[model samples]
Target: MGLLLKEVEVLVVGGGNAGFSAAISAAESGAKRVMLIDACPEHWAGGNSYFTAGAFRTVYHGLDGLLPIVNNVDKAMVKKIDMKAYTADDFTQDIHRICSGRSDPELSQILVHESNAAVKWLAKHGVRFQLPFNRQAYEVDGRFKFWGGLSLKTQDGGKGLIEDLRRAANTLGIHVVFSTAAKRLGVDARIGSVRSVFVQTADGIEQEIRATAVILAAGGFEANSRMRAQYLGPNWDLAKVRGTPYNTGTCLEMAIRDASAKQAGNWSGCHSVAWDAHAPPHEGDRLISNEFTKSGYPLGLMVNTEGDRFVDEGVDLRNYTYAIFGKAILAQPGHTAFQVWDSQMIPWLRDEEYREGRVERIIASSLSGLAQKCAKHGLTNPGKFVETIAEYNEAAVAFQRENPSKKWDPGVRDGLSTQSKTKRLSLAKSNWAVPLIKGPFMAVKVTCGVTFTFGGLAVDPKTAGVISSTSNSVIPGLYCAGEMLGGLFYGNYPGGSGLTSGSVFGRRAGKAAAAASKTWNEDIQLLSRL
Candidate 1:
């Protein structure tokens, strides 16, 4: 086939939240021609964004501040809800704490400070927001108390988020072409600036599309087994994917290989979680989506094949710990673990992930019976499992007796722990420690589900322009956002922060690209006059 050519003021590669954000922002910022290309077909248009819970961790002024943008709460519901303000400092602390202070200071500050404005911009483009009642809040004392520092989500989660973004893009007249994969970044040798992109269509035809500016928001290499094994190390090739199969890091590779983009952030780290062991290994189920996540470990206990507890399950709230716990599970024997909860705590498990039919559950009336049932599913030592429960129960009961005032409140760090001055176990449940006395016990098998990779290109925090690895400077007309633009996260990630980071930088990249495109046009006109 002949090399087909096209021209646009701005070209965006990737169709997830970040790409859509950039396309919309570019169009709104006065770029007349903005085109977005996705490697997947129209059916797989949203990339990983479609599989998200659509939760966005942004700085908000509590209930009154978020009410103006959210659509789910009524006056009665609002009266029953208690939410605290999440300030820029709070957001910054969460990022730093979760990432172990390895997050880039400049990038994190930009993300934290611009988060509220980014969400507001998304809402202005018709994306609906709502309080995350089911995921981030718990009912206590006839009221819904929000916790985890995450209060907002899209109305229908990721599906709704993508739909709204697509609607806004179409309304803004941004051209979207599916089944087009970006293969290379075409740079002008004379100017050392991005001037074109070589792409491949579905029919095996290659084309070079010239553009004044290009924005890369094509996500990470989570879905690529080869790349995952290469960067994330041993057995990552076997980790189940939690999102799109299309995010194979094509555009990210193109930027690095062709534009000499500097790589940044944690190459070995990723956002993973305790997913249903039975879920698909290579790709995420669009219908089931985020339901595969098993985040209720904080409300219960997790045990490996040896029936021994490995990590402190209640060390922190689920938001802060869930992302890293998946790696812990993967490191265990058989790369699997059982999340055990009694009838008393089962009711609190979110229906989206733990409902009766959502995942296979093993139930038993006694702890011994539960252990025996788990043995059939790879629990190597039933006797040790029963013993572990007994020891944990004794520690928990003794701690409760020592500190009677400490209440077990899942909504806060209530100080209900399994460690006491006189009596302590090898490992302790730091908070919400309740003895496993109530039975009709239930357990679900879980394995690691890789969400997104943390390693990506380095960019200017202010402009979101990709930095050249050789020159240590911005690659003039090349910009990036979302998972492709890293340095914001390291060892772990705070829940709901990925989507927020995407929008925060996507907006910046888009606005800057549009302005740069306009300048390029002006320079061309001046040269023509000369």
Candidate 2:
């Protein structure tokens, strides 16, 4: 017995950042009824945005204009990094570079142009931000920095933003259902359009939801190892190590199983593998710190089972991490890299609880404690570890002494500190240094934990509908945005672009769906009357 599901003007499947925007945008655009259905099993509390250091990259905002040096160095460092330096030519070039020519140019253009307004819209929705400051080069412009505009991650602020959006949806009479997970897209075979969606509620009651349009913003599958191996290659270990727990690639299965869908760009998946061995459940210090220069934290040398410092530890984070990941792929057992840091980094670790996101720290009082931490984590012998630390320290001391006036970037600078503050402590006084190094040491195992899967469904910008590559026509009533839509990221993702792209495309999709709803309502109502 088939149940005649209740109908809505628009159906958004997911409750994270993107889905929230999609439902809100649809209601704001005059949709008679908008419904956002999410499993939110525990709560969509920690998706990519929560774990991620929230950033959005766009070209028109003038971030590129401010720090051309950072822009130039970024270009020099990585040839394929997407550079949307506000110039149409540069933006297009970056898009092509990142996409590797596997994207719809028209859709890419629309994303670039609308990003600025998308950010502003977030602010309008009560997602307040810190005062903007100039950082490195921005997405398209040089003015967009991490501080440009971002809501503080307060319980009131973060939850309040979502509540405000939900309230707005309620005022417009949009249906917002919690604990409802979209099982799959219901496609009408007779007309070849999205008819409804299958949902499973908290009590395990399976229900159907009929809609005029289905916007699939259910996120990607970074947590699924089988999918990771399928898309990323045979060697890729898709561990549930990082990113969101709900992102098990269920959405990707929905797309692949459907015969009508066409997959799109695979963004820069070949980046670093981020795994936190000391992460939660069993471990206390859940800080999976990265040894990247851009991460703004000092990193000691990273070694494989062979105990060799492979790449330049002081290079740009992406460059160093990419190199390490490559080495990790070849290393014994593969996908595991040992991060060796001294007690000097303890301050950063202790203060981590107050900070948001992943923070891992392991304490030890003696050499035996250090060895035990390594042994417990399945690390190789700590014998070479001591030698590696000493060599690096010696090199750092020499480098800092020779380069006194150079106010160097933290990541690129040799691990030695010539800064007046660090100089006062001196390597002799530091516990992690050679003579005093008999005490505490820490190491974390890393694999590739992701913020969101960069890949997603393909769509046309003009209509916000899934496009058929063979026919070049819109897949009627099937739309996507946020991490669910692919090709917005070309090569390297600009910091804030992920959230910004979600907002931009979500609004565009909402407006289009609202306009299309009129025809849908009349047809459905006629069918009901009959």
TM-score against native, each model: 0.98, 0.71
Backbone clashes, candidate 2: 34
Per candidate, the number of residue pairs that clash is: 0, 34
Model 2 over residues 267-307: C-alpha lDDT tens digits? 33533343453343211111332221123222454655445
State the number of backbone clashes in model 1: 0
| lDDT for each residue of candidate 1 in 1-530, tens digit (9 for 90 to 100) | 11233999999999999999999999999999999998888888798999999999999888998999999999989889989999989999999888999999999999999999999999999999999999999999899999988999998999999999999998998889988889888898887899999999999889999999999999999999999899999999889999999989888888989989999989898999999999999999989999999999988899999988998999998889888998999999999999998888999999999988889989999999999999999999999998998888899999989998888899998888889987798888999889887989999999999999999999999999999999999998999999998898898988999999999999999999999999999999999999
Best by TM-score: 1
Please list the C-alpha lDDT of all candidates, in the order they appear: 0.92, 0.54
In angstroms, the error of model 1 at 353 is 0.4
